[model samples]
Target chain A: MAVNTIHREPPEQSAYRGVRRVDHSPQIFNNQPARYYLMWLLLPAVLLLAAISLYPFVWLIYMSLHEVQLAPGKSDLWAGVDNFTRLFSDKSFARGWVTLFKYSALCLSVEISLGVLVAVILNNSRLEKLFITIFLMPMMMAPVVAGFLYMFLYNGTFGWYFWLLRSLGVLDGGTILGNKSWAMAGIVATDVWQWTPLIALITLAGLKRVPQEQLEANMVDGAGPLRNFFSVALPNLYPFLLIAILLRFMDNFRFIDTILIMTGGGPANATKILPTYLFDVSFKFFELGRGAAIAFTLLLLTILLGLILTKIFEDPTRKIKTDGMD
Target chain B: MTSVTIKDVWKYYGKTMAVKELNIEVRDNEFLCLLGPSGCGKSSTLRMLAGLEFISSGEVFFGDLKVNDIPPRDRDIAMVFENYALYPHKTVFENMANPLKLQRMNKTDIKERVVWAAQMLEIEELLQRKPVELSGGQKQRTAIGRAIVREPKVFLFDEPIAHLDAKLRSHMRGELKHLQRRLETTTVYVTHDQLEGMTMADRIAVMHEGVLQQLGTPGEIYNHPVNEFVAGFVGEPPMNFLDCRIEGAGDSASLVYDNMNLALGGEQSRILETKGAAREVRLGIRPDDLTIEMGTDHGLELSAKIFVTEPLGGDMLIEADFGQDRMTIKRKIAELGQPGDACGIAVNSEKLHVFDRDTGEAFF
Candidate 1:
């Protein structure tokens, strides 16, 4: 029966004609009800967030130029660029830069290393879902509460850490928090402990996108686990690692709330990062113009760092470079 | 080239079996096709040979060596996947040379081999282009070239030409057959398309539901299917099965079904005469063996009404209602038979197939 075949009027022409013909069907264009429903659904959230969130940002930039008086019914003065100049001259602001760099370096380095290690371990685990949920618990905790909790843990005398360190001959100090050398260390530890889970989560997400077929193909090609990780896994995780570093860098820069709750800029201003210094200048000393200048400068630093990290991290040709290898 | 042998191989994922006790011998330079419908375990069997999948039980042999535990790289087999798994970022030359590079062949040797394979596949000019820049047929050719350059002991192909358009599929089928004849590397090709298996394979292994139904040359499968499944699956407008019972004695003995009496003449009459009217059987008849007529014959005379008439370019397919059941007859395209026209069919007794109704096995 090979010679006998059946043919029908090709369905393609009819389908094309049907699609081209318009029937003035109300279902096609009468979408005002859906539009009205969508507007209603999004309107409340838009109004509420705009009122409570973005309005303050606008007001903050406005108040940054003008000085507010405590006296009732008193008008403020606008001193443009004056606060910015004073902020530049302040040695504390310079120290804030040093502190910011030191804290960010410590936080990002430890978190990235630990995050990658944990993500690698968790990725192949049988209880991957369970382990991820358990590991991400620290990041879910409030950073301020976590910092205060760690502060108590690092107490000198009555705390278990001090007694334990004394027993180990590593603690002759009255308190680890009291020493300028250990103050920044304490801040870094708090930030790292709370935020490392974020890095782990993002890294794990990246690991998930790496094709299983590619890995299996490598194995069939006689590449062992170590070579696969170095050649395939790490190179594939490039964008994720970049994103993790950028996020940690920005988060570490604005990590003043936890440090404030834990050490309050510490003994001799050792842990006085930009955010804490900005808080001290603007709220504590009421140097509004200087504080606003430092805040804006910190904002600029964040944007600059974000742009650089994004450019490096989101290199679209990363896939071509890695899989491009023969 | 080396022979590849699967020795009672079984593959299971958890409790579900993917392949069950499949045993096939691929002689040196033989183009054997594992042909079946989807989920029929053809691809899994090919993958097991390629060492891309683990064998749950039984051993696979490369030449005389047991390769159950040998890795794919050491197994010296090249595979072309259905999706044409070319390294998208690399030039076609680089993709083709990867296996040779893995062997640490000299740069000149790699270049020579890539050029030779590319030229054979008529893709020499496109060697420097990436996979995304090539058409579907071009990419498939590059994938084939990549496998060819390896010069492996065996070649495994998993539905490599399935993604091409219908016209391209037929064109590439001819090219693949030519390529295989030149290379002759004991290939094991897998496909769900029966026509692919028929056209290219020296031997086709027909499978269904992880069970091997028949293994033979394409002609053997078409003329002598071992069972109903094979009979139904092998041919286009597949072999029609009509439930009928034996009647009469000696030369007068015939096959009788609802509303028709088939007169078995010649060898079929003798075959049915000895096997009395004691059992029911399925009459397997190819469409070409049945003629549409307007009158009675010394054959089965069943009146039918044409439900549809499809006039193909060279032939026609007439679907008609025989009693409560529907049957189709193939005829010349020049027939004037239209829908609702009454007609009769003459069964070609010389080509009649009597299958045991219980087991669906041929009772010739």
Candidate 2:
């Protein structure tokens, strides 16, 4: 046998023969260190963030410590903790937190359920892209505009919905926004209409990422559609669902605009949620110190809620492995 | 176990026909492989049998039942996808026990069955691990175990081991064949690899362009391909083909290519005359059937220059150029050859294949 050895040079040695290595030493600018350049590069964004976010936050804290009279002849006075003390004693302020909780819970639950149902239905449809675009129209509309549109539609005299409710004997010709019992329900309905599509869009993306093979395997394993959803599809959608719910929760927690435009905290403050109360205290009655106090409290609550949700989202097993490093 | 029969089944995706007029019967406890290249409809036919895909027309029967309208779950079939398809969030035990749980079986029985399948696949120790934590081969075993725990009427494997490394794939091939035999279930496997099909299947069905080209045992399919496609597709390094013309009739017929004239054997010549074989045909020969020597000594020998030599462990594959045509010959490693060297080659007339040039159908 004539065996010929095909001698080939090592690839790295041949390819690198004429090439020069890149310098890894730190670079300098104008006789300054690399950190100086980094600081300069970040200066614009840092300054802008400070001007917009930090400056306002510090001013709010400073304002919360002093009572400033809106009257031209009056002077500002140091209030110490008096404004915060008033926050606890104010009945409307206490009721606002309760209203905020109820609204967030109701809106988030209904939105997530309806969004998942829509996403699942659209996932199997042949005209998925067309229907998805159509379904997303509500979310594309500005929330304040949607609120105004719903307000006109909920009017007792000429609104189509009011007439339908009266014909159906559900409302007996009463205005949806004017009735105390239906005021919160009307605001919640408007929020659901405008924001449910956001949840649906995210859920649809998650549904698309579910492996087709796994679903087929489920079918072959004797799972019906319902069983497949519970065992396979639902588990795969958890991470995305969690994210969607968290976003909706946070947004609903600070909700104000739609309620402000539609109900204006009417019908004996039935729809007076936290942000609406904040607006009423700060701009309407001009209680700048107490409004700043309420604002600071809401910020703290948001941060705490975010931390708790993030803790829940972390996988316990992954957490344990990371904790072992300590 | 139940035998599966597909009768005149056709599948269409939009306007494109994926599987056309397919009819096949997988006997009870039989291991049948659907073998073809990509887009050849082998996977489509298997999916139809599994009831994962609807048959565009015709019927599929399991034993005495016509299952054309039956869903996959009702058909009592289990499948292992190419990606394994083990539930990512579930432990191996949960994955294996899922089918039994869906059947509403008791907890103890489900556990026993899952453990038994795990042991069968030699993955008992990894039963508690999630799919993401296991290696590819282990994941494949879990998928097989999931199917096994179902103990369904038929097992459908859609290139299940295609993703594994070569060594693991070969090992799993043997394991799957043994497991299927022990379980005595009717199994239909699909793969584009001819080697996997030849090694594992009791019968091989070769498809091309949505049409079944040939159906036979591995030996029969390799020895007697019905068309040029199967002949070219089945062998390692593939069979070499030369454009040639058949002249004369009966026993005097000969194949003429370039300046070489080779007389046909008696059996081939008789068969060709009966078929009214086309004058323009392709002469097919496996590289293993050609013999190369240092110089021409026989009347049937032809002279050619060696183009290249590839040593593939056990044998040397030589590409020899005869005029403008090139044909590969598998020779013993002891047969020394260099590029530009002239060698005499003789084809084994008994093993030669002849096909119509235009239609690609074999004459015999």
Predictions in order: chain A TM-score? 0.79, 0.83
Which pairs of residues collide in model 1? none
Question: Model 1: runs farther than 4 Å from truth?
Answer: A1-54, A67-74, A158-186, A229-246, A267-270, A315-326, B86-101, B104-135, B248-253, B263-278, B294-300
lDDT of 1: 0.79
Lowest-sum lDDT 10-residue window in model 2 chain A = A1-10
CA error at residue B231 for candidate 1, angstroms: 1.7
B20-59: candidate 2 lDDT, tens digit per residue:
9988999999999999999999999988888888889989
Top model number, lDDT = 2
DockQ of each: 0.15, 0.27
**Pairs with steric clashes in candidate 2:** none
DockQ of the two-chain complex in candidate 2: 0.27
Per-residue accuracy of model 1 over B1-364 as CA lDDT, tens digit each: 8998899999898988888888899899999999889999998898888788899999999899999888776888888888877665457887788777777899999999898887777777788777766788888888888788877788888999999888778877777777777877899999999999999999999998888888999999888888888888888887878888887766676888876787776566676555542458888988888888743342347778888987777888888788776777787865577788888876787777888888877766
What are the per-residue Cα lDDT tens digits for candidate 2 across A168-216? Answer: 8888535899888888889889988888888899999999998889999
